[model samples]
Target: MSSRYSFGGDEHVFVEVSEEMSLEAFFKALSMTNAVRDAEISGVTEICPANASFQIKFDPDVIRPDDLLTELRRLEDIADRAEATLDTRIVEIPVYYRDPWTHETLMRFRERHQDPESTDIEFAARINGYSSVDDFIAAHSGAPWFVSMVGFVSGLPFLYQMVDRARQIQVPKYLRPRTDTPRLTVGYGGCFSCIYSVRGAGGYQMFGITPMPIYDPDQETSYLREFMVFFRPGDIVKWRQIDRDEYDGCTADVQAGRYTPRIRDVVFSLEDFNRDIDGTNARLEETLYAD
Candidate 1:
């Protein structure tokens, strides 16, 4: 079970947990190690019952495979009993997807999907598990949480598992896409779980747009550093919804440069664009939390 951990060409650790192994047990085994040694460990779980496997990756420069192996070997039992803890944080972002113009804008987006339905504010709140937009944003407080494999679009991160209530978002029926949709708009009929970072046509029903810049090329590191979003693997996310005024103000702050682009802190290089996986784009996970 421990033999599957490998290193990429650039020295990134890649470990796969097969169907036979238990994920809970694997994470328990991983938890015995020091947090510092767990540098940049993030990967996805292939949860098919017949083919369950978790792919883990880490920075090789900070940790050696031999050291990792040794640590795992020596502390395997301890790890198996320890709990994996995630460091979570909350970020407040203001966005304006609820503008009155959204009705028309959404209509345009709906044209791309067959029988695309209009969404009411109450429905949006319900899907996000909030009674109101204010309540929605307020609940999304704490450390930034990252989840795996939300669909990606235009180099923007689409995070998942907003909440159990949010998991029921419906897939669009239409097969064709609209090219005129703005990138900042929320797609999938106000699913609010996904976001588009740039201006482009998409098939997902968009609910609104956040004023914040989803990516920055000038920073030393951007959120897209390795195409991951705000949170690392296994982190939890709390989502909230806010009113139009709050969203407008947030955009104003970003436009005025008061709010730094969080994506810049993790993005590595624009030069690496050529090496990025094709069609795997990202959008910043937009939760309407104010603080």
Candidate 2:
């Protein structure tokens, strides 16, 4: 697929890799972004890679927009020829599904939801043909997710479920954005599931909350001491369902700076994943637990 590069005013160059979202598109976008970052293009300030696109912020005074675009085209070709693989970390996040925190927040915004009478998960489960909420939760936690983009809010991850397109869970954003969303709220919108890094207005349908601090401003947490943001665009996420008791225990650990997510370094291959999605994921998970 040909990439369309357009200037975002004078400071940013937006490169759209595809008109639609797909693993192929995301991989291409990521590959190109990686290449550009490695090239260390002069005057380039930041490279932001999204699901099916990427953006480069630069100082045009140092590197002309035309010149930058030309360099990007060359890098794009290099990326196209490179092997489609990622050496990234898979992190396990324990979630308390149907937790009281997100439930309270969603109830307050029921009028803004598609079904005022039904809870977010209830509505989602019904429309998605799940026999019950338990079944829906199972489906959600069954597959790993890829961190496609890393900001709707600081440190918030926009995750694409790592499953075949036909098996993806889809949900609509609220009719209107909610004035408030609890921090660490596990929310889903469209084909993405996100962990709300901090409390603020949001439109994603709330499912639950995680006790682990995904975004630590103070870098107080053990895992976050190296980087305030716990997730990156290429990280993998495995969801583990937890009860309220387990959630409370995790909360205590977080308070004591003793909580650390289960993480495993993995080499993900697009070809291998496409060949055996379930087996690949199973091996990855086994490595995580075996550690």
Candidate 3:
């Protein structure tokens, strides 16, 4: 389907890839936007890729809006004919589930939650048809997730699971936004997962917390030294459940500026993935953990 184009006055143009968010929509938008970037079109100042769409900022004085739209359509046609692959990294993240920090924060915000009586995990497990929280954890940590987009509190990534839609773990956000959320709180809302990069206001249901910092302006930590923002769109992530002891240890390493998240560079083929989801994901796993 062709994209829906809307102009944000004379300076910006928004292209909606699909009415609803899906992997297909994301890929189409990404491919087209990337093509635009590689082409280095004049007057195009910024390209922002979201889950199912992209917005481009441009100077109308250099290129007319209708001309820019025509170029985008032409570029997308070329991009569609090309193979779909991405150079991205697979990262292993350590998550301490059922931690005390998020627990305390949730309790304070009970009135805003769907179930005030149960913890976030318990609520999620119940709604997702898991008999136990342990089973829920197994299901969650069992699969890899794709970083669909990076936004919502700077450097915070929106993750979509690599499983089929029927197998997705879905959860509702809080009834009302919380004034406080622990930094690095692993959260889920609808079908997407996220790690809170900063502590402020949020509505996503908190599941766990990672000791890692996804964003830091100071770049004081070893991991953030390379890039202040740790996550990027198209990055794949695997969750490794950790105990309190391990969490503390990792936190110590982070504070001492000695910790680095385990990462592996991998080329992802969307064609192969769409053809055989399970096989493609398995191959990605092998590439990520190859010894």
**Total backbone collisions for each predicted model:** 35, 0, 0
TM-score of 3: 0.96
Off by over 4 Å in 3: none
**TM-score, every prediction:** 0.49, 0.98, 0.96
Candidate 1: where is the Cα deviation over 4 Å?
A: 1-82, 95-97, 100-105, 116-146, 150-155, 162-174, 189-192, 220-236, 260-291
TM-score of 1: 0.49
Best candidate, lDDT: 2
Model 3: per-residue Cα lDDT over 1-291, one tens digit each? 678999999999999989877788888888888899999999999998888888999999999999999999898789778777888899999999999999999999999998999999999999999999999998888789988888877799999888878889999889999999999999999889999999989999998999998899998989888788998888999998999999999999999988978899999888788889889888888887896
lDDT of 3 at 83: 78
User: Of the candidates numbered 1 and 2, which has the greater lDDT value?
Assistant: 2
* lDDT value for model 3: 0.90
**lDDT for each of the candidates?**
0.42, 0.93, 0.90
Q: Give lDDT tens digits, candidate 1, residues 1-291.
A: 443555555444344444332324233323433332443333211211111223334455666656755544455445444444433433444445455554566566655544456343334446556667555334332222233323344335444323233233434423576666565564443222445666766655455566655554443233335543343333333333556777777667655657544322222121232234121112123322222
Clashes of 3: 0
Better of 1 and 3 by lDDT: 3
lDDT of 2 by residue, 201-239 (tens): 999999989999988889889888998999899999999
- Where does candidate 2 stray beyond 4 Å? none
**Residue 102, model 3: Cα distance from true site in angstroms:** 0.9
